[model samples]
Target chain A: MSSVDRSQRSNSTLKTLNRVFVYTILIVSSLMMLIPFAWSVITSLKSNENVFTHSAFWLQFPPDFSAYKEIWNRIPLLKYTANTLKVAVIVTFGQLFTSSLAGFAFAKMKFPGRDKLFVIYLATMMVPGVVLLIPNFVIMRTIGAIDTHWALILSAVGSVYGTFLMRQFFLSFPSELEDAAKLDGCNPFMFYWHVLLPNAKPILTTQGLMAFQFIWNDFQWPLIVLNSESKRTLQLGLSYLMSEYYTDWTLLMAASVLTLLPIIILFFIAQKNFIQSFKLSGLKG
Target chain B: MKKNRERSPRVSLLAKNKIREALWGYLFISPNFLIVLIFTILPVFFSSYMSMTDWNILSKPNFIGLENYQHILQDEVARETFFNTFYFSVLSVPVSLILSLLFAVFLNQKIKGIAFFRTAYYIPCISASVAVSLMFMWLLANNGLINQMLTSFGLGPVKWLTDPKIALNSVIGITIWKGLGVNIVIFLAALQDIPPELVEAASIDGANRVQQFFKVTLPLLSPVIFFVTITGVINSFQSFDLVYNMTKGGPGHATTLIGYYIWKQAFDYLHMGYGAALANLVFFAIFILTIIQWILRKRWVYSEE
Candidate 1:
C-alpha cells in the first residue's frame, strides 16, 4: 500500500512538471505564429516614414486608415475580389461534383477495370503539379481559354486529392445503407443523391473549405493564364501592385490586408466546422 | 403457352437490368470523365508532345524529336537549379517533420486550452503565401525585425534575402514555420488513435514513459510519420509561391527551385518545349519516390482489420 502511494505521488509530481513544460512551449510557439499577422495588421496602419524607421512591433500614435484608402485608390479591389470569388465558387462546384462522382465509382462500383482505374487515379496524384503548368497553359491557349476564368476553373476541376479524401470518407460508411436503398427500389443514382450525399456533409464541407482556401490564395496559375488586368485574381493583382510601386510598403501592406479580410472572415464563420473536420479527418486517416 | 410467355418476359427483364445498370454508371461518371479528358489527360499528352518539339509561344511548334530533352540534359543552369531544389527539399523536409512531430507529441496530452494553441499554429498555414512571404521579406531582411533583434543582442544583422549564401536557408526557415502546424495536427491525430490500453500494458510491464513511447508508440506511429515525410518532400520540391514572392529567383539564382525554373522558361523566356522537358523530369523524380515509398508502405502501415 505504501509503495503504491509513493509511486502515485511521484507520478502526480511528474505530471505537474510536464504540464508546465508543455504550456510554456505551446504559448511561445503560438505567439511566434501570431506575431507576423499582428505585425502586418500594425504595419498596414502605420505612417509611411515611421513604418520604415520605427520598430515593427510598436506604434507611434493612433493607427491610421490612410493606407487602406491608398490601396483602394490604387487598384480595383472590388473587381479583383469579384474575380477571386467567381473562380473559387466555380472551382469548388466542379471539384465537388467530379471528385464525389469519382469517389463513388471507386467506393461502390464493380466495373470491369475498377481497380485498375482507381490505381491510375491515385498515380496521377504523384505527378508534381508544376509539371502540368506549361502543358495546361498550352492546352488552354489551344482551346482559347487563356486570359479567361475558364482556364483557372478547368485546370483544377479534376482534383485527385479531393477524390482521395472523399473516397476515404465514403469507404467507412456502412454498406448496409446503400443495400437498404437498393432493396427499397432506389437506383444507385438515387442512393447517392438522396442517401449518401446528405450523410457525407461533414467531409463535403471540409473539401469545400479546402477548395475555397486554395483557389482564393492561388498565385502562379492565375499569373500565367490571365493576361487581362481586370481579370487577374487577388494575388496576381497584389504582385503586380508590388512591382509597379516597389518602394511603397504602406500601400503594399494595405492591399495585402484588404486581400486577407474576406478569407479570414469566411474562415471565422466556418472555423468550428473547419477545426472539427480536421480533427475528424486526422483521426480517420 | 403460359410457360413460353413467362420465359420470354424473364429474358426481357434481364436485358433491361443490363441497360439500366450501364446507363446509370455512365451517367454518374460522365461529368468527371469529360472534365478530366478535356483538362488533365489532354494536357499531360500535350506536354509530352511539347517536350519533343521546339515551340515558343510565337512560332508554331516544329517537331524536333527530343531536342528539348537533349538540351535540358546538357544545360548547366537547369542542372544547377534542379540540384539546388533537391538540396532544399532534403534540408527542409526532415526539419519540418521532426519539429511538427515534437510539437504534436507535446500537444497530444490531455490538457486544457489545447484547441487554441492548435488554431494559432494553423493560422499561418491558412495565411496567403504571397502575404506570408511578403511579411517575411520585411521580417528577415537586413534592418528587419529579426536582424534588429539580433543587433540589439550585440550580434550582426544578417543579410537574409540579399546574400546568396543565406537566402535559401532563410526560405527553408520560412517553410518550416509555415508547415509546422499541419504536421503537428496530423501527428497528433495519429497519436490520439493509439489505444490507451496498449500504453497501460506497457506501463504494467515495468516500462517508464520514455520506454513506452519508444516501444509502444513509435512503431505504431511509423505509418503516419512516413505519410507526413513523403508529402513534405513533395511540397518542398514543388515550392514556388513562397520563392516567387520572396526571392523571384534572385541574388544570382541562389533560391531558384525547379518549379520556378520551369515557370521562368515557359512563361518568361518563352521556351515552352524546354520547360516541358524540365517538368517531365520533376514528374519522373516524384513518381520514382512514390514507387519506392509504396514498396516500403507494407512494412510500416498496420491495419486493424
Candidate 2:
C-alpha cells in the first residue's frame, strides 16, 4: 500500500513537470513565431539611422511615425490599397455568390450529370495554378485585359474550393427545410434566397472570410496580370517598395505593416470563426 | 422559349417538380460552369497544345511538336530547377510534418492561454506570403537580426540568401516557419477528434505517455498527416511567392524552383512553349504522386470498421 501511494505521488509530480515543460515549449515557440512580425513592426516604426540594428526595436521609447507617412506620400499607397480592396471585395462576394448557388444546386437539387460534373470540378482543382499561368495570360491578353484589374477579378471569381466547402456544408443540411419551403409555394430561386440563404450564414461567413483572405494575400496572379503602376495591388505595391530602385527597409516594412493591417484586423474581429473554419476545413481535408 | 428546349411532360406533380428542380439546378450552376469552362477547363487543353508550339506571346504559336520537350530534357537550368524543387519538397515536407505533429500534440493539452498561443502562431500564416518573405529578407540578411543574434553568441555570420549552396535551404526554412502554425492547427484539430477514452484506455493498459501517443494517437492522426503531406508536396513544388520575393531565384539560379522557372521562361524570356511543357511535367508528376498516395493510403490510414 505504501509503495502504491509513493508511486502515485511521484506520478503527480511527473505530470506537473510535464505541464511546465509544455508551457515552456509553447511560450518559446510562440515567441519565435512572432519575432519576424514583431521585428517588421519595430522596423516600420524606427528611424532610418539605426533601423537595421538590434537596438532599433528596444532603445526607442516611442517609435517615429515618419516612415508610415513617407511610404504613403512616396507611393500611391491609398490608391493601391483601394485597388486591392476593390478586387478582394469583388472576388470574395463573387465567389460567395457563385459558389453558394452552385453548392446549393450540387447538394440539394437532383440534376442529370450532377455527380459526374462535381467529380470533374474536384479533379480540375488538382491542376496546379502554375500550369494555368501561360495559357491564362494568353487568354487574358487575347481578351484585351492585360494591365487591368479585370484579369485578376475575372479569373478568380469562380472557385471550385469554395463550392466544395459550401457543398459539404449544405450536404449535412436537412431536406425537411426545403420540403417546408416548397409547401409554401416557393420557387427554386425564392427557396434559395429566402429559406436556404438565411440558414447558410455560417457557411457563407466561412467562405467569404476565406475568399477575402485568399484574394487579399494573392501575389502571383496579380504579378502575372497587372503591370501598370496605377493598377498595382497592395502586394505589388509592397514588392515595388522592395524593388531595386527602393532599398528603404523601413519604408518596405511600413508598407508591409499597412498591408497586413486589414488582415490582422479581420483576423482579430473574426478570429473565432476563422479558427473554427480552419479546423473544420482541416477535418474535411 | 426555354421551355421549348426541354420536353415538357405535364405529368405527375413529382415529375414536374423534378424537372423544375433540374432546370433550376442547371440555371444555378450555369455561371460557375461558364467560368470554369473558360478559365479552368479551356486552359488545360490550350496549355497542352501551347506546350507543343513556339509561342513568344507575339505572333501566332508556331506548332513545333516535341522539340520543346526535347529541349527541356537537355536544358541544364530546367534540370537544376527540377532538382531544387525536389530538394525543397523532400526536406521541407517531412520536417514540417514532424514538427507540426509534435507541437500539435503538446498544444492539444487543455492548458490556460492555449488560445493566445494559437493566435500568436497563426499570425504568421495570416500575413501575406509576400509580406512574410519581405520580413525574412531583412531578417535573414547577412547583417540582419538572425546573424546579429548569432554574432552576439560569438558565432560567425552566415549568408542566408546570397550563397548558392544555402539559399534554397534558407527559403525552405522560411516556408516551414510560416506554414508550421496552420499545419499545427490541422493536426490539433485531428488530435481533438480522437476520443479521450482511447487514451485513457491506453493509460489504464499500462501504456506510458509516449506509448499512448504512438500506439493510440498516431493511427487516428494518419489521415490528417497524409492530407498535410499531399498539400506540403504541392505547396513546396509550386513555392514561387517566397522565392520570388526573397531571392528572385538569384545567386546563380540556385533558388529557382520549377514554378519560378516556368514563370521566367514564359513571361520573362517569352519561352511560353517551354514553360507550358515544364508546367505540364510538374502537373504530371504531382498527379502521379497524388494517385500513388491515394492508393497507398489504405495501407496505413485507419478506416472505420
Candidate 3:
C-alpha cells in the first residue's frame, strides 16, 4: 500500500514538472515571437538618437512623433495607404460578388458541363503566378492597364479558390431553404439574392477578410504593375525606404506599424472567424 | 378525369422552369469563369508560347524553339537558386510543421487567458510579409541588433547576411517566424476538432501522453499535415518577397530564389522569353509534385478517400 502511495505521489510530481516546463517554453517562445513586432513599434516611437543605440532594445516612453510627422514629405505614405485601402476594399467586395454567384450556381443548380468546367478551373490553380507574370504583363500593357490600378483590381476581382470555397459552403446548406424559395415562385436571381446570400454571411465575411488581407499585403504584382509614385501601393512604396540618399529606419518601422494596424484591428475584431477560415482551408485536404 | 387532364400542362411548365434554372446557372457562372479564363487559363497557354521564343522588351519575340529551355540546362544561377529553394523547403517546412504541431499539442490544454495567448501567437502572420521581411532585414544585418547583442555578450558575431549559407538560413528562420503563428492557429483549430474522448480512450488503454500522441493523435492529424505540407511547398517555390526584401539575392547569387531569378530575368535583364521558360519549369514541377502528393494522399491521410 505504501509503495503504491509513493508511486502515485511521484507521478503527481512528474505531472507538475511537465506543467512547469510547458508554461515556461510557451512564455519564452511567445515573447520571442512578439519581440520583432514589439521592437518595430518601439523603434518607430524612438527619436533618431535612441534608435541608433547599441543596445538591442532601447526603451523610450512618452514617444516623440517627429518621425511620424516628418514621414509624410519623406514618402508618399498617405497616398500609398489610400491606394492599398482602395484596392483591398474593392477586391474584397468584388470577389464576394463574383465568387458567390458562381458558388450558388455550382452548388444549387445543374447546368451543362458544370463538373468538367470546375475541374478545368481547379487544374489552373496549380499554375504558379510567376508563370503568368510575363504574359500578364504583355496582356496588361496591351489592354492599357500597365500603370493603372485596374491591373491589380480586375485580375484579383475573382479567384478560383474563392469560388471553390464558397461552393463548398453553399453545398452544405439545407435543400429546404432553396425548395421553399422555389415554392414561393422566386426566380433564380431573386432566390440567390434573398435566400442564399443571407445565409452566407459567415463565408462571405471569411472570403472578404481573406481577399482584403491578401490584397493589402501583396507586393509583387503591384511592384510589377505600378510605376509612378502616385500609383504605388503601401508595400511598393515602403520598398524604397532604403533609398540611395539615406535609410531611415524610423520611417520604415513607423510605416510598417501603419500598414499592420488595420490587419491587427481586424484580427482583434474577428479573430475567431480568421482562425475558423484557416481551419476551413486546412480541411480542404 | 379533369385533374388528370390538368397534369400535362403542369409537367410542361415545370420542364420549362428547369430550362430557365439552367440558363440562370450559366449566366451566374459566366463572369467568374470569364475572369479566370482570361487571366489564369489563357495566360498559362500564352506562357507556353512565350517560352518558345527569344525576345527582349524592345523587339518582337523571335520564335526559337526550345532554345530558352536549353539555356536553363546550363544556367548556373538557375541551378543554384533551385537548390537554394529546395533546401529552404526541406529545412523550413518540416520545422514549421513540427513546431506548430508541438505548440498545438501543448496549448490544447485548458488554461485561462489561452484565448489571448492564441491571439498573440497569431499576430505575426497577418502583418504584411514585405513589412515583416523588411523589419527582419534590419534586425539580421551584419551590424544589426542581433549581432550587436552577440558581441555585447562576448559571443562571436555571426555574419547573418554576408555569408551565403547563413544568409539563406537567416531568411529561413525569419520566414518560419512569420508563418509559424499561422500554422499554429490552424493546428490548434484542428486539434480542438479531434474528439477528446479518443485521447481519453487511448489513455484508458494504458497509453501515456506521448504514446497516445503518436498512436492516436498523429493519424487523425495526418490530413491537416498533408495540407500544410502541400501549401508549404507551393509557397516555398514562390519565395521571393523575403529574398527580395531582405537580401535581394545577394552575396554572389546565394539567396536568389526561383521567383526572384525569374523576375530579375524578365524585368531587369529584359529576357522575357527566358523568364517565361523558367516559369514554365516551375509550373510543370509544381504540377507534378501536386500529382504525386495527390496519389500518395490516400495512403496516409486518414478520413480521405
Candidate 4:
C-alpha cells in the first residue's frame, strides 16, 4: 500500500512538471511567432531614431505615426490597395463560382464521361504551376494580356484545389434535397439555386476567405505579371519598399502591418468556419 | 420550325426523365471544362514545343531539337540550382516533420490556454509571406534585433544574410517557422484520429506513457506521417516566395532553389526554353520521389483494419 501511494505521488508530481514544461515551450514558441508582428507594429509606431536605440519591447515617450505618413505619401499605397482589392475580389468570386459549379457537377451529376473528365482535371493539377508558366504567359501574351490584371486573374480562375475541396463538401450532402426541389416542379438551375447553393454557404464563405488570403498574399505571380508602377499589387509595392534599402525601418514595418490587417481581420471573422473547412479538406487529402 | 419544336419537345419529355439532372450537369461543368482545357492542357503542349526552341519574349520560337535539354545538363548554374534546391528540401522536410509532430503532441494535451497557444503559433502562417519576409529581414540582420539580443548575452554577432555558409540554412529556418503551424494542425488532427482504446490497452499491459506512445500511437499515426512527409518534401522542393522575397537568391545565390532559378531564367533573362527544361527536370524529380513513396508504403505503413 505504501509503495502504491508513493508511486501515485511521484506520478502526479511528474505530471505537474510535464505540464509546466509543455506550457513553457508552447509559450516561448508562440511568443517567437508573435514577436515579429509585434515588433513590426511597435517599430512602425516608433520614431526612426528610437527604433534601433529602444529596447525591442519598450516604447519611449509618445508613439509616432510619422512613418505611416511617409509610407503613404511616398508610395501610391491607396491606389495599389485598390488595385489589389480589384484583382483579389474578382479572382475569389470567379474561383468560387466556377469551382463550386464544377464541383457540384462532379459530385452529384451523372453525365457521360463524368469520372473520366474529372480524372483529367485532377491530372492537370499534378503538374506544377512552374512548368505551365512559359506556356501560360505565351498564351496570355498572344491574346494581348501582358502587363494587365487579366494576366494575373485569368489563370487562377479555375483552381484545382478549390474544386477538390468543394467536391468533398458536396459529396457528403444528401440527395434528398435535390429530389424535393424537383418534386416542386423546380428546374435544375432552380434546384441548385433554391436548395444546393443555400446549403453550401458556409463552405463557400470559407473558400472565399481562403481565396482572398491566397490572392492577397501572393507575390511571385504578381511580380512576374505586373511591371507598371500603376498596375503593381501590394506585394510588389512592399518589395519595392524593401529593395530601396532604407534605414527607415519604421516605414517599412508600417507598410507590412497595414498589409497584414485585412487578412487578419478575415481570419478572425471566419475563424470557426475556416478551421472546419480546413479539417474537411485535410481529411480528403 | 418543326425541327426546333422537336428539340423543344425534348425539354418537355426530358423533364419527366431526369433531364433536369442532365441540364444542370452540363451547365455547371461546361465552363470549367472549357477553361481547364484552354489553360492547363493546351499550355502544356505549347510549352513542350516552346522548350525545344529559343524563344525570347520578343520573337517567335523556332524548334532546335533538344538543344535546351542538352544545355541544361551542362549548364553550371542549372546544376548548382538543382543541387541547392535538393539540399534545402532534404534538410527542411525531415526537420519540419519531426518538429511539427512534436509540437502537435504537446498541443494535444488537455492543458490550459491551449486555444491561445494554437492561435499564436498559427499567426505566422496566416501572415503574408511578404510581411513575414520583411520581419525576418529586420530580425536576422547583423545588427538587427536577433544580433542585439545575442550581444547582450555576451555572444558574437553572426552574419545571417551576408554569410554564404549560413545564408541557406537561415532560409531553411525561416521556411520551417513559416510552415510549422499548418503541419502541426495536420498532425494534431492525425493524432486525435488514433483510438484511445489502443493507448489504454497498452497502458493496462504495464506500459508507461512513453511506451504506449511508441508502441500503439506511433504505428497508428504512420500513415498520416507518411502523407505529411511526402507533401512537405514536395512543397519544400517548390519553395519560392520566401527565397524570392527574403534573399532574391542572393548573397551570391546561396539560397537559390530550382523554382527561383526557373523564375529568373524565364522571366528575368527571358530564357523561356532553358527555363522550361529546368522546370521539366524539377517535375521529373518530384514525380520520381512520389512514385518511390507509393512503392515503399507497402512495406512501411500500416492501415487501420
Best by DockQ: 3
If you score just chain A, what TM-score does every candidate get?
Answer: 0.87, 0.94, 0.95, 0.94
Instruction: Write the residue-wise lDDT of candidate 2 on A1-285 in tens digits.
Output: 999999999999999999999999899988999888888888878787766554432555587889888876788988998999999999989988899899999998999999999999888878888889989999999899999999999988888888887888888889998899789998889988888888989878877888889889999999998989999998988887788435577888888888998999999999977886666556433
B140 in model 1: Cα distance from truth in Å? 1.9
> Tens-digit lDDT track for model 1 on A73-129?
888988998999999999998899888977887777655566776776666666677
Model 1 CAPRI quality: medium
| lDDT tens digits by residue: candidate 3, B1-305 | 99989998999998888888889999999888888988999999999999999988899889999999999999989999899889989999999999888888889987656776677678888888888986786677555678778888998878887797688888888888888877887788778888989999999999998999999999888877877988888888888888888778987888888989999999889899999999999998888888877777767555521
lDDT of 4 at A153: 87
Model 2 Cα lDDT, one tens digit per residue, B258-295: 99999999989998998999999988988887777667
The C-alpha stretches of model 3 lying farther than 4 A from their native spots are A244-246, A283-285, B1-11, B299-305
**Comparing to the true complex, what docking class would candidate 4 get?**
medium
What is each predicted model's overall lDDT from 0 to 1?
0.81, 0.86, 0.84, 0.82
Give model 1's DockQ, 2 decimals.
Answer: 0.52
Q: After superposition, how far is residue B180 of candidate 2 from its true place, in Å?
A: 1.0
Per-residue C-alpha lDDT of model 3 across residues A77-196, encoded as one tens digit per residue: 888889999999999999999999998888889878989988887787777787888999989988999889999998888788889888888888999988898889988899889888
- Residue B193 of model 4 has an lDDT of 78
TM-score of chain B of each: 0.94, 0.92, 0.92, 0.89
Which of candidates 2 and 4 reaches a greater DockQ?
2
